[model samples]
Target: MSILVIGATGTIGSLITQRLADAGAEVKALVRQAGKREFPAIVTEVVADLTDVPSMRVALSSVRTLFLLNAVTPDEVTQALITLNLAREAGIERIVYLSVIHADRFTNVPHFTGKHTVERMIQSLEMPATILRPAYFMQNDRMVQQTIQDYSMYPMPIGSAGVSMIDARDIADVAVAELLRRDKASSALEPLTLELVGPQPLTGASAANIWSAALGREITYGGDDVAAFEGQLASYGPTWLAYDMRLMMTGIQRFGMQSTEGTVEKLQTLIGHPLRTYEDFVREAVAEG
Candidate 1:
């Protein structure tokens, strides 16, 4: 069966497209426009914008499985609802959604709350679905790569609180497996929520140390100053976006972010290998530079 992948150019979705292609699955990569050089040769690119109902309908046509990964936007919930409605109409069988870890609880975080809204709707659909709530992305730090390279500091507002941050590549792996194959049979599979996390959690100090060791340089945690961090982000983008991130980071520190519980086992069960360690991510990042 063919699978439709949305948000195909994003950090997580891009990898999902590649993984699905690599596994010899028929993949339809949905894009707003067809740029010949953008997608891999294996993918069949379909032009569809999330808000464009006709386009989304055309993309969902004849696809059994759908990988739903929408970006954080002011109209995120609206776009997701539109797509979900169309997917239902198209009679798609399964949907694999990428969401944030504990998005249901952190009502204060704007984007997290948005994902939770879409997640509840997806659950209500009469279809088999998997909602993956991945912890803070390890690659999120790459947003501040400038500060990391020039100042030798991990400037995320994670504070000293330990976060069970996950690599986005691992998140993509889970999506690919659930879409093409599964750890269990169809009769056994049902609506499931997997809090995808890395093998271990890390405090700000611990993460800085990992990068320091991996990069062979002295790095430091920039400490917990939500206002200052938001100001820095504001310098680059919308102030409200930065404010929303400040709220999420504040919620993380206020409500502890480190809890692997049964997720590592769940991930290992899905991907047929051990969970990826942050150390491995660090080494890979360093080597890529």
Candidate 2:
């Protein structure tokens, strides 16, 4: 079976591509550029942009399954919708869409709202898809490594609600499983949505504590200040994205990126292991530095 992976150069998507290739599956990577990286011999790299219909059509051509991961952008919804529509027209049935946890509830966040729109589109279209709604990525903590090491502070305003941050590797593993399941099936399977989360929820303070334990030093939680966070982000990146992130943080503060009952068990059964913990992530990150 042939599978096409969108966002194949990204953090999670790269992992998914590697896993799929390791399983002896034929993989195609849809990238905007080529010669930037290398892939396994069985993998084919297709240079294509989401906005370019002809290129995307070529990328979707002859693929039996797709792992769609639209990066958070101003046009995420548009990109996803176009790709999905093209995939359907091309007779691609099996799909795994990377969506955000609580995409429906976080209406104020642009990316969340965009993903919700895509989810609705998939549902209404009656596509055979699996929506993986993951929580805040634990890898996001890498951005704060310097701050924690320099100032002994954890600077993310994840607030008191406590986010069940998941590891990107876990997300990739589950996605590969879904894609393979859909590809090997005799027919199109039912559409499913899974809430992928960590083993436990952790607040900003708890995250700091984990760092403290791992780094063997005191690390305090930089209190919930969405404004300061936004300002900091804007100083380094696009203002629009910074503002969009601010709204996301505001939503996280109000209602954390949490999981429902049996979420952990369900994910464990799918991944075939216990979920990775924030402590382990912090430990490995600190040790690597």
Candidate 3:
């Protein structure tokens, strides 16, 4: 069966696309424009922009599954809904959505609640789906590469609270398993929700220490100041994006990022391996430098 991947050029989406193709699955990537950028020769690349819903139908042709990943944009909700109706109409049998951890609890966070709304809509439509709720990405630190490299410190107001962040690569692997697994329930059943998170809870201080050990330098933790954090965030993204992120961080500070044993069991069920740790990610990242 063929599978379609939206947001194919993005961080987690790109990893998911490559993993499926490498496994010899018949994959179709729904990108904005195929000719503008080169993709792997294994998968078929289709020109379909989420901004233009009309072009999406062509991408769904002959597809049985969809890996739906939308970013934190003003149009996120609108885009997902549009894609949902089209995918259902096209007779796509299954969908795997990339969502944030604790989406149901965080009603005010735009990206979280927005995805929660989509999750409900999908269930209401009786569409077959698996929701993967990934925790804070360990790679989020990449945004402050300059601070880490030049100042020898990590700058993000993660507070002293421990968070269960996940490696995007692991999320990609589990996404492929969900897509290709055919023994799942009927398309109309309640979707399966799984948590994709790190092996342990890590505070900002602990994470800084990990990076310091990996790089042989002391990396200080940036304190918990939402306004200042948002200010730095706005430098790289729009003001609203920064605000949204600060909200998420604040949620983490309040609720702590602990995961259940069930989450680990789910990961083992999908990949039959222990989840990757932050130290492992940091070592590889430093090695690549």
Taken over the whole model, the C-alpha lDDT of each candidate is 0.83, 0.93, 0.82
lDDT of 3: 0.82
Q: Please give, for residues 1-289, the per-residue lDDT of candidate 3 as tens digits.
A: 5888898888888888888888888888887866654567888888887768678877777888888999889999999999889888998768898888889877778988999999889878777888888888888877666678788877767766678888888888899888878324344344788888888888878888998999898898877788888888788789989989889888888876667777877796778788888899888888877
Give the C-alpha miss distance for residue 169 in model 1, angstroms: 1.1
lDDT of 1 by residue, 214-244 (tens): 8789999899899998998899999889899
Estimate the TM-score of every prediction. Answer: 0.94, 0.99, 0.94
List ranges where model 3 is wrong by over 4 Å. 183-190
Cα lDDT of model 2 by residue, 1-289, tens digit: 5899999998998999999999999999888889667788889999999989999998899999999999988888899999999999999999999999999999988999999999999999999999999999999989879988999999999999979999999999889989999999999999999999999999999999999999888999999999999999999999999999999999999999888899999888987988899988988898899
Model 3 residue pairs with clashes: none
Q: Which stretches of candidate 1 lie over 4 Å from their true place?
A: 182-189
RMSD of each: 2.0, 0.7, 2.0
TM-score of 1: 0.94
Q: Which candidate is the best by lDDT?
A: 2
